[model samples]
Target: MNRHRFSTEEISIFRRSLLAWYDIHKRKLPWRDWHDIDTNIVAYRVLVSELMLQQTQVATVIRYYETWMKQWPNIKSLAEASEDDILKCWAGIIIDSIFYWSYFFHLGLGYYNRARNLYKCAQLIINEYNGEFPNELETMINRLPGVGRYTAGAVSSIAFNQANPILDGNVIRVLSRMRCIGSDLKKKSTTDFLWSLATDVVCPERPGDFNQSLMELGATVCTPQKPKCNECPVQNQCLAYQQQKEIESILDIEQCSANCSFCLKSSDVDTNRSLVEHYPRKKSKTKQREETSFILIIYRLTPKLEFLMIKQKQSNLLSGLWSFLEISSSKNHLDQMNEQKRKTYIIEEIQQMPTIDTIPSINNIKLAGQCRHLFSHIDKQYIIYYTHCEQNDVLIPSTSMQWFNEEQVQTSAISTAMKKVFNVALPQIKLKTSNGKKNGTIDNYFKKKNSKV
Candidate 1:
């Protein structure tokens, strides 16, 4: 790996400039309120903020963070809280944008696995560490279920004031541009090299502020697109800026290398301002795999209406979360089946289940149209089917399955995918009752329940 070496004076200038800029321009976030606070409380706050900020934007996390602190306040309180309550707290942060015509939200708060992991993490800390967060990075990573390298480093440096290096996405972008590293970020070798650069430049005296300054600079000034290079405090020490200046100094620009030595990519460099934005070239994203599932929104018209929901197994993708009964087409031997055969296959599979002995006639079942829910690497297509069964015909569910009334389903720890399924299927189910299609009863239920958030 080709490395950029800075002189002692250059490194000193870089650190001083960045720290000075950070002191003046840092965003006033809830997690950064470290003044007059205990070390344990600081550690807990940092842990929670880091976990919440994973793959979520800062603007989205701020209100959620504030609400969480008010509710839980500390690790002990969080540990004592129920998983359902924690999920409710998380729901406060989730942004649900409903399109006019579609029942599915554009983005759902689909972090069910992370929420479960957080519950287990809080329990682990309370039981193992006596309600105190671990200070050592190694212990934090080893003992905590979901604390990865970046999170561990952030907590150790920010909360404990330890001289640790963090390589989050923001820090990676900052370091890559500052040092003119043009390697593919998806490669492990490139990531290791960036971590080395992070370690090399981290200030020993104020490790917390110094590390955060780099990340802040990336988020505020050194952005992914159209970065404000002229306003950057450490522009003097930036290798990418220097390379851009060199290209701009050329008399015959066409004679210069189309692929410059810094980024090793073709570029005109006609505008020095835009050159810095091109250094951290990212690799193309991998295509998401397509998956199809048959979701059964089985309901009974008892004295009060009740829906059948199943708890996801520990071995499943959304472990410990409750969702509608889903039969993946892959497992049902319907990969090659036609549309009619697929529906038939789903009905046959549901009939075979021991817990559900009798269901309504096929003519009475209604298809509530298809809805999509996206995971990190899977594009899930759900064929929602609504069926009504008699109360006497519906057998008592085993330990894995439970019958939930409208109120229970509304307040349960169900995934956003299941929520979408419910939102689409419930209206059709209501049409069979006295309430007409335009009554908006299901919408009222979700609004009344989730409105507190």
Candidate 2:
């Protein structure tokens, strides 16, 4: 019945001794270079790594990071690349995409495009701060786009050799095991306690090395699983070790997951239990839904054979994106002529707009290929329909409507669903205007109506 706890004085000694151990045994990583901090390369690396590490492992990021760096070394290069190309770089990491991580790619792109903002922060360092990375954590944290307090401390101490304490999951684990902290690390009180302990233990002069050393020790020696107590530099001073005869024997007293407070399987009674194998069961799948969509591709040749693109603003899901007019239905009964009860449905759906009653001025209509896009919350099955319109009289221009050439459309931040739409519609457009093929159907109708008037 031995409890592991350390006094404030002993914690300071642990910090200094662990830092000395880190001086001898720290592993070299790509982002640790002294000269790279001032450049965007390190910033980009840190951003991408942080993004990639969300719900993913460090071992998985190595090859992907290397390949991405080799292909697009800088932010400008990444911005110039296609979404498909970026997705290729993110080939293996798709399974790791939870809600927050799904937005990582977007955040990365946002920051990359806004590199001038980053330079605003970086240039000030070279010019005003004299090429030295900022030592004060809060100042550096305020400049970056997405960096929070913990991340700021990590970068400041590790990159700038500042006297800042890092309180990541690894450090929390070390402190929790040493003190036998029963509270969950996610709780605010637990976090505050751990941060205070981390501050108490950090060696001031080489705080960066000291912090990294603690993390490195937790990652390698004081691991969540069978910790190599013999290899630990400060094993003699550790309260957990001094109370119990040996690390292995102490760990054996409880389940493997119970000893490590950060273990995913940790519970209130016994925190450490090897539940890694059982984690997949938490995410069980149910029956998938079937959905259908009708996408309209209307074309007018006034501005170099451009198609009508609508900016969907009604819903936040597809808001402000240039897409075709779309309708989602439960069944594929679009071709069935609606002579009865169709008007009521149309009136209800298009409550504000009454212009949809007169066949919608659709010219020659062609059925394009179907596409399927799967989302976490919803499933979509798209059937594309293209209509050719060489006549200018019927074309309407509003804030939502845009006519862009193929080159212009290609460079935009279009969704993957729209990309699939373009793949099928482009060839259909070429077919309509292959040999002076005009939109005669709609033109003839307009001419006849004008004669009647």
Candidate 3:
């Protein structure tokens, strides 16, 4: 890899000029402004926004950040809110793998816990330090959870008046371009060198401002592509400028603005004419799977409307997701009961079969819905049937089953498939007494509920 070394004097000149340029051209952002900032609130916002920004674009983070801030204005509020609500906010963003989404939720829970720590830190500030954020970077960083070096540096340099160096994408880009370093930026040694350089150049008195300025220059004038040499304050000192290399034409300024990197590639007509046009391709074929099963469970409920939901004992793919118990046919039962007989048996068992006959209190058994939930790896078609009794029904479904309402179901940590099942199945079982005229089915219940509300 090609590498360039900078003399101590050259580094000093660059740092000083960049800081000067930042003073004049720093971009205005909401988080950086201290006026009217509730330190704890801003800290929480910063933490959430930063977490969401990982492997995601700034534009995508903006609306989500605002939505979350609006919903849970404080750490306590966020912690108290349902994970489902939070996950719903992250709906389209989640990769849809039950495992990934589950892990992501827990990861966010860590952040929420960190927010609580920030709250505690804030309380300390109000009680002891008179509401001022600690000026020391180490002190502040030590108080937050999951706040590693980069985040700590970002917060300290941007939020508090601390001189901490940040090694982020913009800084990496600027460093790569300025020093003409060709070593992969992803390599640890290259990153460490950049961090050392960043630390060495950070101005203590205006550490935060100077650091932000470096980022600003990298983001704007000394951008990843088509750096505006005429507008750049330190163009005279730039090695790329002095070398008079083809670096300036490395990126097409217009194409770069439109997120068209391929378009930026210089194409000479003669060499490329024989190739096919790049874009359209036929869709790949998907395999069709055939699965048959009888999802069996007796839905017994208490008179007061608490429906049973069971958690699985075995850790299957949708291990943590909820569903009624399924009874798989042994080879003999399946062989003996032909397809039609099997279907009839399933309906009868779901509607009338009770492991326990009478609830200790008033409870009834009923049919819910028959539907299917499709997952990427498996398709779960459920023959969901429901039965109900009063709140104090005869039996609570052993340790596996707990009663939950529709609203509660929304917040439960269930699989996307289970969520789909709940959305479809919940409306089928109605609690109210009808004139026996299909009085209160799930659809009608929802319609009436919506209209009344």
Candidate 4:
């Protein structure tokens, strides 16, 4: 799987130009060097940020990263933290950022496995590595849970200045266009070839700066839609840009090799998009599966205003996060069931809750609200149903299933779906105190709802 060898002269020029651009243009990310002299701390920081930034956008990841570092700060702190703590920290905690509390955009950050994996990695670092992060890739870094080649490469090169290669989405776009690769990117052959190219061109001496530069170049300049070719520092090195300039003649294109099978042919050019955009052939997206579920907010009004919340046992979807009792069903099944049947189903589901010592008779079940939430591969419809216990009944609490008052619900680390449900459901709770009077002003409830972290 050898790529066309890049000469030392060409590699040197690429490295120099790319690094210069990065120094001037790289985004001021929080996980970047914090003037920390210890390379271990720097490596730990990079690993955490990479894990968080995997499925979420940078804007969303920034606040979470800041909150995480502030709480854990180091490898030992993260390892010492409980699984619940890790999950809660991984979920959005905005007590610190009161400035954004009024209008914080709540992104699900759903892949709960990433958070669990982060916790596992931290424990491994402590128990196995004596609280020190393993610097070498093969030594222990890549072996860490949820760490792949790309993440390992990033940590190694960026933190230890190791001569490793990284190929993220941005870098893939940049390299595919640079080499004018037009094959199906979803295919293994194209991916392997791109990895080979990435390995070949990585700067040996300043690998850290070089990798960051390439990523920055792709992120800011060589963007997917309309690449700023005129402003690209390495436009001279990009074959697709040269192709777009009508320098397709083999002699004129400096980067083009002699009839290479790896490069896109002239016939591959898409008229709809320019030549550079054509290189990285866009992969067709798979349609998201439709999911329909009933999120039952089983509550009580006797002792105080409290709602029952069940901790999710499923790891694949919102794993270990707290939400109301959920009953999943097919859309057709849900449609066929009438309102009375749905309540019967809810009653039956409540009876089966593992921790319930006594299944309280539901007083009045009503449709509070409904909302749609999108996961990575599922479009979920939440039919929010809320009900309370009879006048003399109360819900017994357990480790997995606990009760939360309004203030606690506002502060707890519930799933984003549950939070969305609360936005609609809680206001209609008829917030009555034990003495059967309106607890607080409705305006305060609205204010508290708006400030949910």
TM-score of each: 0.56, 0.44, 0.43, 0.56
Error of 4 at 78 (Å): 0.3
Best by lDDT: 4
**lDDT winner, 1 or 3:** 1
Candidate ordering by lDDT (highest first): 4, 1, 2, 3
Could you give candidate 3's per-residue lDDT for residues 29-54 as a string of tens digits? 54454477765666655556656665
Per-residue CA lDDT of model 4 for 400-427, tens digit only, reads 8888888888889887777888878876
In the range 73-124, model 2's lDDT, one tens digit per residue, is 6555665566666665565454444434665566655523323333344445
Superposed Cα RMSD, model 1: 22.0
What lDDT is reached at residue 173 by model 2?
A: 62
Model 1 stretches with alpha carbons more than 4 Å out: 1-3, 96-110, 248-263, 267-273, 285-453
Candidate 1 residue lDDT tens string, 1-453: 233546677778988999999999999999998688888888888888888887467887888889889988888888888989988776555542112223134234345556667778788889998888889999988888888888888989998889899998789888877877665677787788788878878888999999999999999999988888899999988877766778745333223345434343443233343557755655654346678888978787666778988788899889898888788876346557876776677788877776455344443456787899998767898889877766667556776678899889889999888888888887777665434223457566556557768
Residue 215 lDDT, candidate 2, scale 0-100: 81
* Over 4 Å off, model 2: 1-9, 33-48, 71-88, 95-136, 140-143, 246-453
> Which residue pairs clash within candidate 1?
none
TM-score result, candidate 1: 0.56
